[model samples]
Target: MHILLHDFAGHPFQAELSRVLARRGHRVTHAWFAGDTGPKGRMARTEGDADTLAFLPAGQDLRYSKTDFLRRRAGDIAYGQELGQAICAMKPDVVISGNTPTEAQEGIQRACRQTGTPFIYWCQDFYSVAASRLLARKLPGPGHLIGGYYRFLERRQMRRASRVLHITESFRAQTDAWGIPRERVSVIPNWGALDEIGVLDRNTAWAQANGLGPGTRFLYSGTLAMKHNPELLAGLARAVTAGDQVVLVSAGVGADGLAARAADGTLPGMRVLPLQPFEVFPQVLASGDILLAVIEREAGTFSVPSKILSYLCAGRPIVLAAPGDNLAAQILRETGAGQVVEPEDTEGFAAAAQAFRDDPAARQAAGAAGRAYAEAHFDLERVADKFETLFSEARNGL
Candidate 1:
């Protein structure tokens, strides 16, 4: 079967899935936008194993802008049309869409219907909810109106999908409210690249070269957008005591904010860096003493941070600032891999970081537990097999 996977944000895990599916004798094409500035970036379009194709439309930029709402909306509509055209051209047996803008998803769904191609929605996050929260915060009165428009598009696309592969059960209620049948929704949690990320010693040359060898480092190594609270990281930095050699290393959006704060002498012992290449991600993850994950309370259960899975693979104890009932917190509690603090509790977050820093045995135990959990539950091959079954079922109209 020929399969096409579309995601506006080019994810490395999707590429890994394509390789796994192709190795199983299925032709797979992973299509994404060229404008994603995430960790994968251009590498997502260029690197893939044999029998798997990475498709990025030439000269197409679909990155969203915070300041230019009208321009961003227009770009999404244009990109949606282009994306539909591309899917129609491929004419794959099944199309899977994940992490797509609502408008773009509408276009893909419409194209699939017109072509009689079965398609599944690999629902990673609730886009309409996210847009509503963000726009409501920024635009006040008109945000709900704009968000309602996206919600309409979201409902149409979800109703049109042959199957909805939800990443968490938390989404079931919303889909149920939309009148989607329970049988049509399946819960398939996201998995980590256990093969790529592994336990590495902190004494490696990469750690020493990057100034990560001398102190207790708290690292956050993924996109920190509006859904995350950067001020929590700033608060953690401020809470570091004089005797503690705690350092904060951030490599994404929070890094930019923390860098500016450092320049102003507000965030001492904070080192901000650009997102690392995928090849060097293991080294970057290993350099940290404790991994950090944060989510805004407003995002609630609508989004789950995928970085937590990578942190699990890295075999490091995590300090997550998220709601207690959020999926990240639930995973940490279930796996015994990390500590979870409320998003607003800066002191609690600092305390957890200090405990991990001071207690080597506890940190080692947490790391080992996380590694064991990843091996048992987050294996890439296992995840690929689940996706294969879903694809087959969708193609057969099951």
Candidate 2:
């Protein structure tokens, strides 16, 4: 079978999935937008048996610019059209679209319908909910109108999909209301690329080289967007005792915010660094005494932070601030691999971090438990097998 997977955000896991499917005797094409600035810089294409296609030209980074919102929206529409044309040209046996903008998804759905191709909606997050939240803050009166428009588009795409692969069980309720049958929806949570990440000692060379050994490092790695609560790190820094030696390290947007705060003498003991390369991810992850994950209360239900899965692979105790009902928080509670606090509870977040910092034995135990859970549920091969079966089923109209 010829399989095509598209993730607008250019997630490495999607690329890994293409490789996994290729290894399983299927021709796979993983497609993504070139504008996305991941850990690795933009590439027109990647060399592999499973062809990697990057649509759009390089140097189109517009994700963080509020002034370019309208321009970005127009770009999204153009990119969608381009992606639709590419899909039509490829004419793969099956297409799986994940983490796509509603506009792009609609384009793909239309293209699939026109070409008579079976495709699955690999929904990692609901864009309509996010759009509503973001636009409500930016443009109060017209936000609802625009959000409703996207929701309508999303419903159409969801209804037309041959299968809907939801990352969380909570997503099924909304799609079910669209009259999508339960049989057509499957909850296949996201997984980490365990082959690329391994458990390493905190005293590894990377840790020592980065000056991470002397202090209790609390690291937050990955994109820190509107969905994250930046104040959580600020409050944690302010609350830690003088002798605690608790340092906060951030790599993405959060790092930029924290670095600015540190410059202004507001956030003490915070170190900001650029995102590490994928090759040294394991070592970078291992340098931390504890990993931090935060989600805004409103966004928690619509999205699960994939960083939590990667943190699990690093064998570190995680401290997550999210709604109690969030899938990420629920997993932590069930596995006992980390601590979950309400998004607004700064004191609880700080106390959890301090507890892990003070007690090495407890931290080690939690880290071990997290690794065990990752081994069981987050192995890349296991996740790929599930996707392979789903793709085959969709292709065969099963």
After superposing candidate 2 on the true structure, give the runs of residues whose Cα lies further than 4 Å from its correct spot.
38-67, 241-254
TM-score of each: 0.93, 0.90
True lDDT of residue 55, candidate 2: 37
> Pairs clashing in candidate 2?
none
RMSD of each: 2.3, 3.0
lDDT of each: 0.79, 0.77
lDDT of 1 by residue, 1-398 (tens): 89888767766667677777877788777777666556662234344455455555421655655347787777777777887887788789999999888877788888899899998988888899888878888789899899888888887788879999998888898899998888888888988788888899876666677666466777878776777788877777787665333344444455677788887888775667777678888888888888888898777568788888888999999999988878889999888899999988888888898889889998999998888988998777778888988988899888
Taking all chains together, the TM-score of candidate 2 against the true structure is 0.90
Q: What is residue 248's positional error in candidate 2, in angstroms? A: 6.3
RMSD of 2: 3.0
